[model samples]
Target: MNYIQGQTALDEEEKEGLLISTITTRAELDEFEQLNIESAIEWTLHKKLKKEQLLSESFVKKLHQKMYGNIWKWAGKFRKSEKNIGVNYYLISTTLKILLEDCLFWIDNKVYEPEVIAIRLKHRLVSIHCFPNGNGRHSRLMADLNRIDPLIAFAQS
Candidate 1:
């Protein structure tokens, strides 16, 4: 496992392609991660989202994959092991499905202000910690992308 600044730890299960020697320092890792995230942001900016896309498990996975696939081998995949945070690994899919449904209802019913919904979604997604790494960033990106319109409508544009 690569130590970030000899303090914080990156996941030990990072892809084999990531060598401690290749990125000896946290600063280097930060730079690489930033570059990857920038590219993902660019992609989101250019691509038009559809309503169906927001409700998709595949879309969430793909977005995470796009954001971190280059940095981690397990980018698009869920964690197999339990972490100190998040629901059980097995519950990820089910919990996410429920969240999506709730989000749909929120949009359909105008249940909350758009900003509140976005913040709520972001907070809940971070809590889920769906990915081995980059969950917070991934969730934040998802929330930002979701702000394009009225909840579900955001995905439409």
Candidate 2:
């Protein structure tokens, strides 16, 4: 099966699978790379930080760097300058917010099934392309956690 992880605007087939994948897919995460998975975690932490939820930014940065430890030393840190992807231009944190606010809407909402929220967050995070890399996997983690985590999903949002 060919699956696109972080695609915000889905083709017809993707939308059908959206709710299904949010539940079953997160259970078996072997298809995703470790880096992608870790970045997803970092993105969630980033989202929380953006909300002023009181998590340490430095720790989240360490986690992000640990995700891509060998390849990029500056993994967790936000880029100092602006970035461009195709025609779209964005600052690092703005991209992060897209994942947090827009993509993670299910998590943002006051009440919803974790299963439901996961799909929404997953879909939206995939859509945001927040980081230069690992966005799909980041979407996955954000979705997965928000789906299961009532506290973070509710308190932070």
Candidate 3:
């Protein structure tokens, strides 16, 4: 795969997950993923989601699935192998749960301003790197969703 500067190259195993076999370059892959992501964003905008639903592990996984399901077989699933960054592969579920709980607590107690909460949640989600790819884009979309609903800045992650 031809990765643009700053774009992370997918490992061979991860690349095999791609649904579109014709895409052999980063730009082509990016364009396809971007189109899929746009559809997912539209889906989120049209749906009626409760706050509790938004903050759950299922929602996070579902959002990822929506964002990349069209392009990757492993889109919504948490990675099963070790990577260069993020919590251990075995600890992804537990770590993400803890992060969500902490965000909930912060919101309940007004522990931080909404913007701070959003940024922290976004940063942490990216750090967690739950999926094999698109963590950064996922984190940003989550933060953007939070901007739409002010109750808590931690939105669909």
Best by TM-score: 3
The positional error of residue 139 in candidate 1, measured at the CA in angstroms, is: 0.8
Q: How many backbone clashes does candidate 2 have?
A: 2
TM-score of 1: 0.85
Which stretches of model 1 miss by more than 4 angstroms? 1-11, 15-21, 150-157
lDDT of 2 at 70: 41
TM-score-better candidate, 1 vs 2: 1
| Candidate no. 2 TM-score | 0.46
Estimate the TM-score of every prediction: 0.85, 0.46, 0.90
Candidate 1 lDDT over 9-78, as tens digits, reads 3455544536234776668877888899999999887776665576578989999888877777778888
Full-model lDDT for every candidate = 0.75, 0.46, 0.83
TM-score winner between candidates 2 and 3: 3
lDDT of 3 at 11: 76
